[model samples]
Target chain A: MSLEVKTNVAPSKTKVMTMKRLKRREKIEGWLFVLPFVISAAVFFIGPLLVAFMLSFKEYSYLDMVSMFEAPWVGLSNYINAFQDSTFLRALLNTSLYSLGVVPIQLFIALVLALIVDLNIKGKTFFRVAYYIPTVTSTVAVSVMFLFIFKTDGILNKILSFFNLPPYNWFGDTRLALPTIMMMAIWSSVGLYMVIFLAGLQDIPMSLYEAARIDGASKIQEVLYITVPLLKPTIFFNLVVSLIGTFQVFDQAFVVSNGTGGPLDSTMTVVLYLYKTGFRDFQMGYASAIAFILFAIIFILTLIQRKFFGEETEF
Target chain B: MKKLIALFTAAVMAVGLFAGSTFKPAKVNAATKKVIRLGVWASSPAESELLDNQIKEFERLYPNIKIQKLVITGDYNQVMQVKIASRTEPDVFYLDVYQAPAYIAKKVIAPLDSYLDKNDVKDFEPSLLKGFTSGGKIYGLPKDYNTLVLFYNKDMFKEAGITKAPTTWKELEEAAKKLTKNGVKGLSLSIDAARFIPFMFQSGAKINDGDKPVFNTPQAAKGLDFYVSLLKKGYAATPKELGVGWNGDALAQKKVAMVIEGGWMIPFMKDAAPNVNYGIARLPKGDKEGDLVFTVAYAMSARTKNKVEAAEVIKFLTGRQALSMTAESGLAIPSRISMGGVYTAKYPERKPLVDMVKYSQVYQFGIKSSKILDALNKACEKLYYKKVKDAKTALDQAIKEVK
Candidate 1:
């Protein structure tokens, strides 16, 4: 009788009734709950973002700090110049190559690590922490350590020399500086994603594996068909986040290159170039243009990734 | 309901009043007096102590004003740029003459012509003073200066069978070639292409030509070719491939028989490599009979909060007595013309300082210093590292890029 009574009501009517009750308290409590966050977001994030956006449209040089308000506005000119700038184009290419190179390799390595850890590998926490050490360590400290290790007379080449390997200038050589930085980025980023993959692996139901086994599916077949398909959403989330992070990689390159992005500007990434333009050259407007352009690229790439790989979950 | 609305209206007005009050700018309370922040390059602990002493003296004279010393550990030009961006630039900061033209062009540095004329500033070297002038306005007063001097190991000179220090370009080349041997080089220079401007000057080539880099001149080509030939004959280190810090560090380590450095090395060598028997002489003169001298000055930021008071502090710090004291301490050769006497009397061993100033050249900053600097660096790098077969071609490319 209760079930029949519940079924008599229209679904839309029930939703409307529930929404009406929600609206009565929402004005007070909803705001009460979200007020702090709204204030913080407005003060910290939105304020700076708006300022940066405005700054992008103006010519603000560091030389004339007092003349900040007097800086003439040249609408869209800075953006146009940024697109035409050779350094920006190179930085875009470098950042693109870095993103393409790091995301796939890091994801694959993370997946393998997740699989290994999922096997209930002995000392799982120990191995996880060991991998995560790089992520936790300060980037400046890590960059300095790597600098010494990769120097001409450093340990890596010293070891190579013992094996009759000819030593090449790793940090000083233009061709290798970017690759070396990329390797470090991959090394530092893989562990965090490994944890995410491990969580995703746990979320896959035991029933699916049992059912597959009953159908005489092999381990490889189970991984290929069940595990990968189930983990698609999580993998896509990581891919998009990493893509953003890699594009904005300033600290590693900054520290490694000693802020010049030199050894022939081969390792000059987009953020570093933005920094040079904004601060070094005092071309704040142009730098703002570059920043917005980067934002657009990241936004577009994320949308494309979502369209292609973002799968809906049934549960 | 009307009473409740009145109460709410009052509350809203109260909040509005508070916000509006903040917008009208606050009064300067006694407790809110601004500290005078002075930014300078990072120094060693010992140097910091000496500066601290100077600061104490400065405070003693002006008890009401508090001075804050900010030390930076990066390129001073970039540091200045960063500080300017933040709108918290120091009242007084260090300025290098090589890159001061840009700051001068922007009027970021205050002109001190009126101050000098009013104060009747005396005992300042005219040539050194002229270096800081732009647009017929004097920007800043130099505190001290350094001219390049050829420093050689007395023992190395004896071993190489060369009795006297090389004076002319041809003799300098022969001495260097004769001095080259197994595990010991003829000379070590801070030959990193980035620092190659001084080298061009040493070779009788000026980097500036009416605010442009015109290295296409025959003399510039000859200068570049000569540098390349020296490198080819194994007389110079590979650009940026040395283990030690520029010329001084290599000299200190006894890795090179001779090097061209500055007066600051006298104190540095006394501390770092005390046992290395070294003597200083005038820099080997270029074919045009000139040498390069580098100088630094204390510049006042244009946006200083207390301009009048800050200028007073700068004046005291860079005055005749202060300059003489600085030279007496042997930190560097004082910028004052009068202190040249004090420098000579105090440091008798440094014959180089006396000779260098007599024939020392100066680095000139043109409108396009950035492009010229980069082009010059690349050209020198190519020549010094033997990357280009033709020095003239590399120089021509540099000239093209500089323009």
Candidate 2:
């Protein structure tokens, strides 16, 4: 009986070795498959990042951009200057306000849209497609259309006049300019977040809802206790993404203002200010410093969000 | 298989590198013809076609030199800046007088003194030539220029019971008030430095006093006050306030009875509002005849490989023959005094625009003009929107910002 056991174990040892060799081969194949993407990312993404980091410490002008290494190193002067600049400060405040104003409203609208479309109703696909159309449209085309709509005698003002409300210069008025852009932002972005929320809604188990119904839960109660808690992860993701996107807003403001950031610079976002400084003013180093500061702000906000929302969701 | 794929990728990249390097003109033999790239911004399709025709004529005259006309569509300065930075700037390009100072200071533009001796620079308007000169050296040759002129809608003037256009500031104010009726403003004012500069000049207020912005002086303040009061009294309205894009747009749509525009507006008015029945006249004068002359010059890049060829192209473009042909397109008044007669004759309505050039001040605010203009524009906007108490305060703020 002992000899028979030894023979059986010996054969099993060879089997284990073969299994280990197969696993090693699979690992090598997986890396080979991902090699192209890694190489491209290293060339494009990592390359620019390294160059920009090096440039941030130097006084890189348009002339210096061609021969990057020839630019004189100014240490942290660019960063210091950015903090001292009144326009940069204003841009920061404006971008923060825009992000704070747009993110919550846009997400709420998106969630409401997602919930309505997720209901047991006909023509659901039609509603989803219609809602998603703005998301797929070109930003420039949409911004140009919105420019006409927000004009003093535009469709929006005509509607306001019907209700006996006075018309305002949406782009020209300092008080209304940023808010008008925010409204457009909320309108154009709701569709994308709604689609994201819909995907999250479908992932939720039906058994949990059925159980809630058996307990005689009201519609509002079910949504409050079950839906809200279960959708926290999705909400967190959308919140972080929208925050970053809204903070870097440029295209809409640039197009509507004709690249001036005018009407008293009320709609000047940080990115727009950076673009003007870098490309228009040829202050690439200062612009890079502004970019890094913006990145820091977004990074800190994301960290705080993660801390409060908690990363893992057991449900 | 993996090695093969890697090798194929390397081969593709190698070929791309070779193709890019080959894009630049290779060192040619002495017998081979040379190519000279000319950069210009075309305001309209007609202007572009006219330029193309001129280029063809130029190439025909000089068989050994090929003229490659690069028609820059938008943001001409920014595109040219990038090209300059990359050391791929065109051999000859259009340079606005207002921007020439900055480019000259940076040594990006070559001094055309040597080239001008043969080209007869004295034939061009002295002030226009003076605009592109720095440190006793000419940097560019003026191609064409325009001054602000009053463009009044005849039908609107008739409706207002006014026969003649306003010839003075006081008359303009009274006429504007009378014309301000039935949702139609008498004048469409644009709150910009380009529009405001003439008023300052009219009051004998120089933009700069030895390299410092002194527009906040009492003379300039007086001019600015009168200008802003027209808006306050509802006699004039800004284009934005009228829900239009510009003064020209307001006039074209009949939103305003009068607008101050440049020679470039003739074609735009013809195309946009054919039946508006408008007449061009000299801009309403102040203490003295005051108008702003905007000029663009043909400047050669300092680092150009073919300097002689580029200078030849510039000379030809700004010469009598080419200027007369281009003037017929009605885009600009010829910079050369001799060709002015030809331009005025070709387009009879543009005579007022040409007449203003004699007394008009060239639009040059020094090397830091863009910043100064931006500050002034903001200040003007503040005054226009009533965010500031008065013109003095607004001008003061602008002066402080510029300094």
* DockQ of all predictions against the true structure, Cα-based: 0.27, 0.29
lDDT of each: 0.75, 0.85
True C-alpha contacts between chains kept, each model in order: 0.29, 0.27
Interface RMSD, one decimal, each candidate: 10.0, 4.6
Candidate 2, true inter-chain contacts retained: 0.27
Global fold similarity of model 1 (TM-score): 0.82
Pairs with backbone N, CA or C atoms under 3 Å apart (clashes), candidate 1: B291-B361
Q: What is the DockQ of candidate 1?
A: 0.27
Candidate 2 per-residue lDDT, tens place, B74-138, comes to: 68877887788788888999998987876887788899888777447789998898889889999
In model 1, the Cα lDDT at residue B111 comes to 86
Docking class of 1: acceptable
lDDT of 1 by residue, B1-403 (tens): 5345445556767999998986354333224544577888987676676667677787787776667788888677777886776776888888877667778877788887666654445566666776778877888877788877789999988988899998877887898888888767788754344334444566666667667666666677776666566766777653234444357877888878888777778878989999999988876656655566678888888878677777776777787667666767777787777778888898887757765665554565565655565566666656654567776777887777655
Which candidate leads in DockQ?
2
Best-matching candidate per lDDT:
2
lDDT over C-alpha atoms for residue A144 of model 1:
79
Model 1: residue B365 alpha-carbon error in angstroms: 2.2
